[model samples]
Target: MSVEFSVFLIAVAFIGLVVSIIILLRKAMATLDEANKALAEAREAVRDLGSEAGSVLGHANDIAAQVKDKIRAIDAIVNSAQDVGQILHTVTDTARKAVAVLNHTPQAAQPEYVPTNKITIRKTSIDALAKETDRI
Candidate 1:
């Protein structure tokens, strides 16, 4: 073969190799672009989640503060109720002691009995009522 012809063939082969490398580089660049897009989407999702979490935390904090205030109010109410109960107990005890002191002397005659209601018991119906209750 002539020298010029061989040189030209070598040059063509080198050009073909360079073209293949450029195509491969283009494909690599496309893949990198897709990865970058996915990364951007992930970052956006993370940012959205962070904001949502922050809002949720803020709401929880508000609710917690309200709950604490309610608990304090309830505690104050309970303490006042206890104080009232203690005062009532003291009054009741003093009334009982006063009554006991007034009744120090025993009376010879008993007081008359007062009946509010009259109850009648039937022997026949009692057994039947007990049997019915047992069946239930």
Candidate 2:
């Protein structure tokens, strides 16, 4: 072949290769742009989620604080009730001890047949209670 013709064919082939490379580069650039847009959208979504999570955490903290306050109030009530129970138990124990001591102590001899009282108490059934309201 003639050298000029071969040189022209080689130039044509090189131009075609360059055109193909440019076309591929354009496609790659478009893909990169799409990827960038998707990444931006994902970043925005993540930011929104972060703010929402912060709001949720704030609410949870408030609820926890309220629960703690309620528990403290309940604990105070329980402590007061426990104190009252202890006071009642102590009073009952003191009364029981006094009764036991009184029962164990010796008593004086009874005087024989001294009638100075004017009123008397009697126990009867409901049939007698109908006629006698004073009997018990």
Candidate 3:
């Protein structure tokens, strides 16, 4: 081919390559924008979920603290009841010992009969629970 024709053909090919590259670059840019928007929406959703999860955890912690406080109060009450039971046990033991030392016998108590209109009268009496021990 002649030199001018060869130069003109090369120039046309170079221009066509540049136009194709520009079109590809524009499509790439549009895809990148869409991807960026999707990422932003996902980030916002994750942030909202994290805040709600934190709030739920805080409420659970508060409930656990309240349960601990109630358990402590119940423990104190149980300890006081045990102390009272110990004191009563000691007093009853001391009284029984004193009665034996003095040789004082307790009289047998008769169960009182209360008249009732009910047809099913109980045959058992709970007033005298122990056997007679040297009645005075």
lDDT of 3 by residue, 37-114 (tens): 999999999999999999999999999999999999999999999998987776556545543433333322443454
In model 3, what is the error at residue 50, expressed in angstroms?
Answer: 2.4
Q: Rank the candidates by TM-score, best first.
A: 2, 1, 3
Judge candidate 3 at residue 50 and give its lDDT. 100
Residue 13's C-alpha lDDT in candidate 2?
100
Give lDDT per model, in order.
Answer: 0.76, 0.74, 0.70
Which sections of candidate 3 miss by over 4 Å?
A: 103-136
- The best candidate in terms of lDDT: 1
Clashes of 3: 0
Clashing residue pairs for model 3: none
TM-score of each: 0.69, 0.73, 0.63
After superposition of all CA atoms, the RMSD between model 1 and the true structure is 15.2
What shift in Å separates residue 132 of candidate 3 from its native position after superposition?
A: 24
lDDT of 1: 0.76
Largest TM-score belongs to which candidate?
2
Q: List the residue pairs that clash in candidate 2.
A: none
